[model samples]
Target: EAAVTQSPRNKVTVTGGNVTLSCRQTNSHNYMYWYRQDTGHGLRLIHYSYGAGNLQIGDVPDGYKATRTTQEDFFLLLELASPSQTSLYFCASSPPDGSNERLFFGHGTKLSVL
Candidate 1:
């Protein structure tokens, strides 16, 4: 099994806020992703990376930024967080073989923008 961990299980901030969500994977996966889950949008990709020092914009990249510092560490940054961006955020990692079935996910970070 893949070991993925997230920090600050929950967070709260006012409008136009700033927040950073963190994730770490110990399985040495090459693909890391950040996603948000909302009532209507389901799961929307925010950002992703192929490996360390690489980044790729996702479906919802307007208000988000991400960085992959190392193969195990990936971070999501919300510079001007808005209420619309409040949602359950998840981090996941997959092997380099391109098999989506082996994706492993972190518990999640719940952010609330007031």
Candidate 2:
């Protein structure tokens, strides 16, 4: 089975604070994605990448930044975070074929901005 690990299970920060969330997958998946889950809005994509050093902007990319440093590592950066940016963040990895059914997700990181 594919496994994804995320650091800092929970976080609390003030407005304009800087935050970095990390995710790593051991299954060697080619596609990695960052998403934020909120009430009413459902899961909204923030960013994604198919390979190292590549990033694709997603639906909610205004307040987020993502980077794929290596095949197994993807990072999400929230610079100048605001209260509206506070939500449950998730990291997921999928096979090269980009099948949603084959995606593996992390436990998630809850972030709160005060």
Candidate 3:
């Protein structure tokens, strides 16, 4: 099974602030993703990467950016964060053959933008 870990489990910041969420995946998965969980929006993908130095923008990309430095490391950056961006963020990893591969998610990172 894959293992995912996130840092700064909780974060608090004001509007127009900045926050960086880090994630590491132990398994050598080909795909890594960052997602944000909100009430009505459900789980929406913010960014993803297929491998090192690769990035793919997701459904919501206004205030979020991500980079995959290595197969096991991925980072999400929130520049000029806003109140609406406050939510539970999750990092996940999946194998290449996603048809039957299950994603492993980190505990979660709760961010509050005041």
TM-score per candidate, chains pooled = 0.94, 0.95, 0.94
Q: What global local distance difference test value does model 3 have?
A: 0.92
**RMSD after Cα superposition, model 2:** 1.3
Tell me the deviation in Å of residue 37 in model 3. Answer: 0.4
lDDT score, candidate 2, position 113: 98
Q: In model 3, where do residues sit more than 4 Å from their true spots?
A: none
Off by over 4 Å in 1: 99-101
Best by lDDT: 2
Candidate 3 on 1-114: residue-level lDDT in tens? Answer: 668999989999999998999999998888999999999888999999989999998999788988898999999999899999999999999988736478899999999999
Full-model lDDT for every candidate: 0.92, 0.94, 0.92
Candidate 1: give the clashing pairs. none
lDDT of 2 by residue, 21-103 (tens): 99999988899999999999999999999999999999989989889999999999998999999899999999887355477
Residue 38, model 1, lDDT:
94
Clash statistics: count for each candidate? 0, 0, 0
Per-residue accuracy of model 1 over 1-59 as CA lDDT, tens digit each? 67999987999999998899999999888999999999978999999998999999999
